[model samples]
Target: MDHTNKLFVIKLTHTLIWMFFVAVIFYVVYSGITGAINTYTWLGIVLVIGEGIVLLLFRMFCPLTVLARKYSDSQKDNFDIFLPNWLAKNNKLIFTTIFLIGLVLVIIRTLF
Candidate 1:
């Protein structure tokens, strides 16, 4: 009900969402590596792309992060989410690379 509670809720939600996407990304990678492409693979791809669009709309920041910013003035990278500072700092770069690799593998498997 207060700002602290609100920020905690936001951070928790953001962390859960991040975990979901991480699972999706790993599923995509697994699908590609195993040549098990299916409807779920496509769904994961679509979800990741949609997430990318959302990030772009927010100028590369998660909407939750933007919202969380209003509640806290911490300069730490992980302030908006329940991630380690280093992980939060490199989250985009790390996950994007993994997603792209999986995408490329998916394309190759699909074409061949």
Candidate 2:
């Protein structure tokens, strides 16, 4: 495909992946808050942790973002994804805080 098409595909894929992770994160939080920990909760936790490792391996950049960089010169934060610019800019901070809170709740629920 052409560069434009390729970039669009990347952006779409990235947005879908972001949505999946958002669901997983919220599920984890919900499970923790409701004290309904189960196999799915553990699976979601593992997936989120794996995502964190991948980000670390990529030096805190999503691999898709790096790949998308080759296609566009736009400096906007949401250039690689369908998120709002402000949300894209602070995506990591926002999600990581939410994830941490959920994790803490999970730990507390599990231990208590």
lDDT tens string, model 1, 28-68? 99988999999999999999999999999999999999999
Mark the regions of model 1 whose C-alpha exceeds 4 Å error after superposition: none
- Residue 23 C-alpha lDDT in model 1: 97
Summarize candidate 2's per-residue lDDT along 16-72 as a digit string, tens digits. 999999999999899889999999999999999999999999999999999999999
- Evaluate all candidate structures by whole-model CA lDDT and list the values in order: 0.97, 0.96
Error of 1 at 82 (Å): 0.6
User: What's model 1's lDDT at 105?
Assistant: 91
The 10-residue segment with the lowest total lDDT in model 1:
26-35
What lDDT does model 1 reach? 0.97
